[model samples]
Target: MFSGEEQGKVQIYTGCGKGKSTAAFGLAMRAAGCGGRVFIIQFQKARRCGEHESAERLGINLAQCPQGRGSGPCTSPCPLLTAARDILKEGGADLLILDEIMAAMRHGCLSLTEALSLLETRPAKTELVMTGRGAPQELVERADLVTEMKKIKHYYDEGLPARRGIEF
Candidate 1:
């Protein structure tokens, strides 16, 4: 349960760097530690990772809604839209993280209109956190708090692969 002093707000993590999802996961962990129910909806991803394992161990609600069947952008919005609707209907989480939703919107998997509508209809007590690169300006403007993770330097730029538990 969130403290009375804690208020629900829209928070966005964007830009061309790392730590966006990591920061969101950190917040989820903090919320869970505070006895808050946290729900995570991952867009445009299907594979399980460290966060999935952590969420399971912590007993957080987790849902994976990948946009397409394979690599590259999805042509249809079937999976994303359906998952979004279902998530909205379920609606009991104190913190809701929509990871990569901006990328989904940018990739044409989710429409700006639909995204805005979902934002508008979000539960009053739910703290919404969104993460992804190339976030739409409309969403940036709508968000209460936004952080752009500019890439000053990254290990991947050195031809290093994404390491397990660190990058993956």
Candidate 2:
């Protein structure tokens, strides 16, 4: 549980490189180690992965919102946005990670206004993290900490597929 006195900050990890979600998960583990309640909501992702298993094992709350066919920007209500609003209202999490939310916005599953609202309305004690590529300038300007991972070199360039337990 958070001490209630600790101030939380908004952090973002975005770029064309890998390790954005991995870094967020690492922070989640650290926060959990210190006895903070952590929640992670993954947007545009439904496939079960290593992080899902790890989060379950570590007792972190995790949910995935997969975009079905015909779902596009404002085409239908976004499940992830709904879930995020509910969680924010409940204010149970000490750390909330919106994994791949930037990608969600890029893919037209979420909007800039909606994302900004999430930032503006989050609980005072909840640390928020958003990840994925192509973070908009608006988000970057508002985030307390923003790290853009530069992809200098990648194994994928050599024609290697993403490996399980490494890429997932």
Candidate 3:
């Protein structure tokens, strides 16, 4: 966006690649640098990714939703959306990141209609970034800017754990 751009906006990162969350977190760090209050609701991941354990120390507020045990479902939208709704309604943040959210919706933890409504319910002034693999085509279309990370190769194919500071 140009420096003189209008209000908060929408952006999305998606695809069958390895860097969606990494890209989104990079944006979060940028937003924090601009002094924008931020909240990250990571779905379908447990065991503390390096970002979760470090965001607060770096001063970005985070709330990893308890949606899945390991790379799977996110079935509790009422609670999830409620939290998001409250924050947007109160206008506490300049930006919000829905990390790995589609996996939740895809796995039946969140309703598509409700999840889609965030683009509407969110105070128009709230900027949002959503990141995930397998993101719905509809969501990609709804976004103002959408980047797809196409995977070429990954260590997961070689039976290696995600490398710290890189895979993350």
Candidate 4:
């Protein structure tokens, strides 16, 4: 049972395989179940997904960047980055999930320094989780827990598009 008083830790789920967001969402659910406030900020995404619906039902706060997918690296004054900064400053969430943040970093939408700064300034009791591929070694080294989802094989390679609810 979660005490609901333990200090939060930084967790990263990254790799080329799938389940990174799924794993983070699972943690979000678990945290919420334990009576913890949860907030999720999805970077470089705009389309509504199954998680958005589930998040509402579960009382988790979720916000997505309007820039959407395949826009390339975001320029200065990225809305997602600004939103993240504001969320961190407000300081009410017990668990904060920066969904696809690593992908944003990879695409240059967000910088390593900014991400690390966010980590440094977040509320001490707020648990942080980042999801996406190609997580930089710097983040991995600083994280308290890291899980790499290696892709040995995927159905996407078989000409199957992402399915609703399952992949979205």
Q: TM-score winner among the candidates? A: 2
Candidate 3 residue lDDT tens string, 1-168: 213355777888888987888888888888888777888877666557778767887688777665454534444443566777777778777788988778777766577786788778776677888888777878877888988899899778889986787665
Ordered from best to worst TM-score, the candidate numbers read 2, 4, 1, 3
- Better candidate number, 1 or 2, judged by lDDT: 2
TM per model?
0.88, 0.93, 0.86, 0.92
Q: Can you give the lDDT of residue 32 in candidate 3?
A: 80
TM-score of 1: 0.88
Where in model 1 is the C-alpha error above 4 Å?
1-6, 66-77
Better of 1 and 3 by lDDT: 1
The alpha-carbon root-mean-square deviation between model 4 and the true structure, to one decimal in Å, is 1.8
- Tens digits of per-residue lDDT for model 4 on 57-139? 99999888777876777768677888778877887878899999987887788889999988887877788899999888999
Q: Write the per-residue lDDT of candidate 1 for residues 6-29, one digit (tens) a residue.
A: 568999999988889999999999
Best by lDDT: 2
Candidate 1: what lDDT? 0.81
For 1-168, candidate 2 gives per-residue lDDT tens digits of 388998889999998987899999999999998988999998877788898999989999998876532345644568778888888889888999999888788778878999999988898888999998889999999889999888999999999998899987
For model 2, which pairs clash? Answer: 1-35
